[model samples]
Target: MSEKQEPSIWQGFKAFLMRGNVVDLAVAVVIGAAFTNIVNAVVKGIINPLVGAVGTQNLDHYSSCLSSSCEGDQGIQLMWGSVLGATLSFVITAAVVYFLMVLPMAKYLARLEARRKDQEKGTEATPEVIEVTELEVLKEIRNALVAQRGSGHDER
Candidate 1:
């Protein structure tokens, strides 16, 4: 018997590139990069100004000195404001992506799946039909067994 040949590296690479998920991932990456710019703009132009109403206009500048001499970067500085700003940006991005993109997509996919199942149900045999068919088959089998027993008794 002939042994099965392994796929070549080039063939495997070509298959990987041709897969639908690879294309989807590439599209997602491009869209994500574009979406990041929009989120960043919103955080800078809108959120920063709203926050600035109570504090500094820029979040990056807000920090605290941990040591006695913080002058000219001489002491340890805790840049908690930048961290807070980053957290805000992350929260905003996640909310927008979830509410606007992911939630809608999930709902649309669910509807499509439901419609597909309904269509399949219409095309395929129903459970009642299958049960009836099974009952008829069982009756035919019983009748055949009874006739066989009658013939056997006559032969004896």
Candidate 2:
């Protein structure tokens, strides 16, 4: 009669918030936002002109109409290059994080978790109980044969 019930919606939400991964994700997101600012500056100040010289950089600023009424209008566009640069920066940052941080961390954590689970299961084969390596067994046999020959000559 005292069985535990499934968690309520709010309780589930609280549990989600308390999870280690959720907290880690929040931190990573904050750092990533800050990182984006740095990357944007690097691209705009350093990389953009280099890339622009290669003709791969988007130089197309803005679409404009040349109608008589619009002759005096200038489509001011420092924003587009910054926007494009920011997009490239974001992609590069995301790739670096995925490869360097998230993927390797996930793999290492999984390996450690698997080892913990194996230890908990207590089904791991005992190293002492297992047959010795082939090299060790061969070395022991060789030593025994050598001893036999040496003893045979001594007995004679």
Candidate 3:
């Protein structure tokens, strides 16, 4: 009798890391993180200045004091500008990802799927003539003999 050897923890971990999904997810996370900086910069350097053309230079400066004694001291401030800036950043990031990455990738995958289906259809369209095996012919003969015997019509 032979004993089965179980895989080690390190081997299991390596297998998990080598999986396509895991590697893809890791790459996505890294790229997303890197892309965030560019989005933030665009929002800060371009959009903020564009929006600032009408008023303050920086969005962070656009805050409303909530407390009554808000003058000359640090009071409760509603930072609506920062919120707007963050929202703009998020929107820009989403738009870039959708238009640049997601849309192109989806189109490519669709083309691949269509091509694969077309190839499958092309192959299926060409009908092949099926040849019966010897075993099938033998089976039919055996069935006929059995039926003839049951009906008491056997010829010696």
Each candidate's lDDT (Cα)? 0.69, 0.62, 0.66
Number of the predicted model whose lDDT against the real structure is largest: 1
1 or 3, greater by lDDT: 1
Order the candidates by lDDT, highest first: 1, 3, 2
Model 1 clash tally?
0
**Residues 1-156, model 3: lDDT tens digits:** 998999999999999997655855686799889987876676677766766787665566677888876666667888898987677667866776666665665555445545656698884322322344446444655565567655774454
Against the true structure, whose TM-score is highest?
1
lDDT of 2 at 123: 63
lDDT of 2 by residue, 60-110 (tens): 454445443443455432346557656776776566556665566555544
lDDT of 1 by residue, 33-109 (tens): 99888777766777667777987655787889989988885999999889987887678668766666656655554
Model 3: residue 135 alpha-carbon error in angstroms: 46
The lDDT, on a scale of 0 to 1, for candidate 2 is 0.62
Residue pairs in collision within model 3: none
Ranking by TM-score: 1, 3, 2
